[model samples]
Target: MTAAGLPMEIRAEGLPTRVRIHEVGARDGLQNEQTVVPTEVKAEFIHRLADAGLPTVEATSFVHPKWVPQLADAERLFPLLGDLDPHRLPVLVPNERGLDRALALGARRIAVFASATESFAKANLNRTVDEALAMFAPVVARAKDAKVHVRGYLSMCFGDPWEGPVPLAQTVRVCRELLELGCDELSLGDTIGVATPGHVQHLLASLNEAGVPSSRLGVHFHDTYGQALANTLAALQHGVTTVDASAGGLGGCPYAKSATGNLATEDLVWMLHGLGIETGVDLDRLVATSVWMAEALGRPSPSRTLRALSHKE
Candidate 1:
């Protein structure tokens, strides 16, 4: 490892030795862009992420173009990823139609997005909380029948814009429903990133009490309030291993105006490596990839690690 990229390793007790990073740069990161990223560029970005050893890279979402125009080329892009392992390339499917599009393209893994609050459900999905789950019911069943791996994303796990801090029971109830709906995994999202370490530990404990094991849960935190890393550490201490991050910190909820970018993969990797956790990622290559992407987006990366390391380069 290059000196610029390597962190001094100090193993932490009671933490998992290895972590699986669920990379979301290609899909979640670019979904909110006002200008569409070319299909070929998006494909190369995914390839680079895979080359950098991201275990699972979410490729694209199959939502209607009118809603997320940037990802409207999902059909065109999924085919270009044939050389990569299908299991490592999960796509987002908002409904049955999206599922059909993904399955037809031979996607072995898929995910559904849900909200913990009714206000977010209404804003993002145009349905009530129950109504949205009703929509995902058949979608999850059909995906399972097809033998596809499914992940459920529960947003506002901590707080919301229209609504205040979400109750633990409300988040737990929705998480249970999604798991019951046959979601193979659930990612708990701190949409506006208002969570502290205590709140994170409490939520994970509450979910464990509700019978949702930490093994089945993943943490997806935004850096809006600069709490993403601290919350992630809290989750790690509680035995949650899967973490969702975007390259270069390049995503936010289009519907949640106050929400900022995601927890940058480079930043997360720095922390994980410093704690002596194995992610099988080449931080040097990952930083290079994010730098290339930042240039493509015509902006500087928001990741502090990416910036500091790239400066050394």
Candidate 2:
């Protein structure tokens, strides 16, 4: 049995609660930026995130530089990552070539993406969803054989850019494929962030009934429709613990033209703390890290709470 005197155990409060945080600012947040952040800068950013108590940080993406020129330096960037104790940095691998590069660099974890909406799939991958999955089967198997842990990012879980809304059945189907491919975790992304609480509840319920337990699911939401928080609550209620949040709400949604912010790590931590959920994060230190990145980018943080906190001190 574990020690009953554990300092931060959630059960100490009465009920058992556990939540996991997946930090994505370095990749998801930085990729959408117009300027190509220098490779050195990117590594340093990841270092700061690791210092901020983020256990898992999405360090970079291995897509074609032509497609997302921002992260063309994955091979070099990842090697430069400062040793943040106990922080595991995962990168996004889009295909076989990306996986090969990750393997070469001795990367232990990577993420692949797909979409449920046909039009969005075509727009994003230039192929139908089924065709893209076919292409990924070998890549996923190869990574697994190489002892690389794979995570899948399924975009447009609630709504899409080209398509209006994604049906629960379609999302479920795509998620099933990802899980079947041996992805250790499947991140449900609100690409356009039009998801509402009710929609999230329905989808989570459907997914649970369909046999994809909440434990295998991670929630990624943007604040496009200002509903990320609400959707997050719904997921939490369903026992979905892992959440993907950007430091300082760094990323913007390309599909949702008006969507300017991601769900900020600070804000999410605050809410989770208020809800009596334990995240094992240091808010003051995390805010400092976010402010540092925001300053490096020479932009304002989308995290309203962070902005206020900075001004107060």
Candidate 3:
């Protein structure tokens, strides 16, 4: 985009002036790693992300260690992030027990993961779609009583591997149930990265017609089909301001083999900056952070923008 690898600013019409990036590199990115990253390294990685001007960084998940062994050190890792604002650091909780763990660590913001399809619910959580929501009901209720901010993540909004082409009505129903269960925000995930721009627009419009405003929605897209950015732009056009991205494109669904890496934060920032949309991220610092983490992980990053910009350095 530039000789120095920065994009030239040109504001786009009908787009939000500022966007909130929900950085997920620390939790979602490392959860699928075969080898466990040191708790100290995880702490430093989160600190670096915060230093790079990420306003809301998802720190870690409180699921059972048996399920996600990589984050077995949630207790150790969360305490080390004491330097960060609790409000800006969100952690994922699978249920009441997970919520207890996070609340014990003074987590002010938390999230619950749900599925829009029955197959994924069975595969990921070993529960039916409604059963999973029923389990989350008490968790959400308790978290709300604790005065904690809650985010509900609805996966497979676009398509599901087991159930091809998830119905729009089905996704909207789960989204509404999540909200009724008292989630402060909902992140619609294109889990397998099969979403196109038009599909994204249609889903957002459907949600709006269902009484779910764009202000409460966020988009999480994977780059498996290379449509992450395009789908993101469509969400922006529909007035959705929050977006979920992993730094250096580092995460995928552990249960779904078809799902690939998430939409890279650097790539998202590049497009947003080019469109003159503010995300408050320092591009240089973010690139450096990703490079550092890549070396720590013993591999190169999967992000095209990370690769392109880091090559210049």
lDDT of 3 by residue, 210-290 (tens): 999999999999999899999999999999999999999999989999999999999999999999999999989999999
Q: Model 3 scores what on Cα lDDT?
A: 0.95
Stretches of candidate 2 off by over 4 Å are: 1-16, 82-87, 253-259
| Model 1 C-alpha lDDT per residue in residues 1-313, reported as the tens digit of each score | 4674588999989899999999999998999887999999999999999999999999999999999999999989999999999999999999999999999999999999999999999999999999999999999999999999999999999999998999999999999999999999999999988888899999999999999999999999999889999999989999999999999999999999999999999999999999999999999899999999999999999999999999883
TM-score of each: 0.99, 0.92, 0.98
The reply for model 1, stretches above 4 Å from the true place, is: none
lDDT of each: 0.95, 0.82, 0.95
Work out how many backbone clashes candidate 3 has.
0
Query: Which has the better lDDT: candidate 2, or candidate 3?
Result: 3
Given candidate 2, what's the lDDT at residue 87? 30
